[model samples]
Target: MVAAAEVVACNEDLITLILLRLPVKSLLRFKCVSKKWLCLISTPNFSSRHRRLASASILLSQIPGLISHLSLNCSSSEKPFSSLDFIDDSAGVKLLQSINGLALGCSFHKLGKPRSYYVCNPSTRQFLTLPPPNAEGHDSFATVLGVYLAFDPSKSPHYQVVCVRNCSLSAAHDRYQIQIYPSETRTWRLCGSPFASPSDIMFETGVLWNGAIHWISPTGATLCFNINQEHLGSMPSPPSDEHWSKRRFRYFGESGGHLHLVEIYGPSTTQFQVFELERDYSRWICKYQIDISPIVDAFPEMVRDYLHPHHHDSLFYAFVLLFVQETEEGSSLLLHIPGKLISYNLRNKSFKEICDSGPKSTKTNTALHIGCFHAHQFIETLASV
Candidate 1:
């Protein structure tokens, strides 16, 4: 009995060491093996260690009903795409944002009907549907601009869902209102508004960084809401030569634990300038200026046949900058051009095409078709809502 007890203790230690190196998805499944394994994986220290070793993946959601997952650490050829079958097909679900391994999704319904919101862990297939926000009378879908999920399961088991809406259209009568629903309380309450007057917050472009949510305003300024402080703040956006009144094509993202903004410019939209926010949140510095001429040069025949004729001056206007994926190997920019998705490496100046089975334009004559697709950085975790 003494020798058997010694062997069991030795096995448990070895098992824990092996499990710590594995991914969260595998650990979640292994939890069902025994009660001991379940308790070990559920510990806070084990969760943090697993998160640190996990690599971020990209979650792509296509209109109507399709969701694909791609790993950022591996090349396009090496990683196989996996579809998310757990999400209900009939819900007409649209992914809003992903944070701390939980994705916030909303299911659309007919007009005047309340939309259903869900917080789900794609890896674990665990989900929680949030109760409807207490909005009286004005229950139309148009009233709500955006719903963002703000939760870090590492800190606490509870999560918060924030809803931004135009109060004028609702019964509130305020220009804009911020409502927060805490999972612990299971109730919705109005929070403080960030903007002084009526201003359109780019909720779709909002990126969570440095314990706060950042969004680009129409007037070339960044509006921030600190998750820890629950306060509003503003920061100056990158200085641009273009007029502030004009719509600027830009995206907010994070790479290597730092916030970055990618601004697309030039006649053909071939020039991509990347700016990284300083750690102090003081100013932005130019990081890389990538030229897509090589990619354009690689496919000369297609460019000349399709692009030159339609866009006489701007031959590369079909290409749109999506987001930047930074890894230990290097950083690459993801671009969408017509039916293809291309990844351009900033370090070696190499371009690789990512196989996408999403929707494409049937018309061969058109240079590009802006279809309905969304992509975001995802980290797999066992965090519950």
Candidate 2:
């Protein structure tokens, strides 16, 4: 082994190429192998190259307690790692959003103290605190609706946090405003004048895609905020009939630089279509047709027959669409079930269990709804927080 190492180490070019292909965890350990390896991997250029080529893994968080890492590319039995443990547990810190490899965390407000926002790289266990939004007298009454992280490592290492808040003009009229915190500036600034957005829209669940943050409302209204131009705009969602007016989208997220939306029109159905937003915001194209009837046949527990009559809104009440992997080879879906995470290939229709949640499922125990869990794509990087 020593002789083999020496032979491979003879050429720095070959050594660098091999190291770049290794996982971030393994590369960190390899750094201690020799000073040469440490110096090579520690360089900014090497880190950037590794980050660009790294495959993304989904980080599943079930609020105050559990956080599981699910890798779609690698078929390993390695246990999930707790990425948010570095933050103080007592602070009631909850992960709001994660982009690239950095996570945006929000801590609950104490008695007199204001809430806190943190940008952290879970891989490095490094974090940075963000300044509070500058709100004067009347604006002080505004409540934060959602906080989102926009970090595209492929574009730049620096990140930006977009905070959407609701401003009340009266008991009848409520307007919304946006505040942005760029890592380069380290201060919060209002993005644009307050505007009236669609009612019943979940602003807090904005998905960053194609240089913009997009939010799809239950009423089928879609809004996007461009980070570069600092402009708010609207986009088109997938076409729907009267039966789909309620939306009932299973997932709306970005993966592999593409925006995807999954809306299950009817209640007790096992089939759905995945839509991809065009780069030009022209229209949503049907990317994949998903039919999980075979999975339900195999895992009878996934059926929603157990739900009470009142709660029987959908057969997917127990299934959560965690992550979707779009690759050149094919596409696959990662779904969160009761006690395990199942990966179903869209191309071949094959499925397998990727991660198990032990005796008591963390999400099932904590979340009133079985589908309630936060999932973010994590790409391992040596980038600084």
TM-scores of the models, in the order given: 0.83, 0.85
Model 2 C-alpha lDDT per residue in residues 159-200, reported as the tens digit of each score: 888888876656467788899888888888888898998787
Minimum summed lDDT over a 10-residue window in model 2 is located at 358-367
| Displacement of the residue 232 alpha carbon in candidate 1, Å | 1.4
Best-fitting candidate, scored by TM-score: 2
- Number of colliding residue pairs in each model: 0, 0
Q: Please provide, for model 1 over 1-385, each residue's C-alpha lDDT reduced to its tens digit, 9 standing for 90 to 100.
A: 9998667666977777789877666787898988989999998888877777776777666655456665543435322224334666454666777777788887756465567778888767777877766565566345677677877766777788877766674344457667888888888887875344336557656777777778886667668777668877876677675644644645668766778887655446556678888878889998888778878777553353344566577454556566677777789887666556677888888887765433443124335545455677777676766
Error of 2 at 32 (Å): 7.2
How accurate locally, in lDDT, is each candidate?
0.69, 0.77
lDDT of 1: 0.69
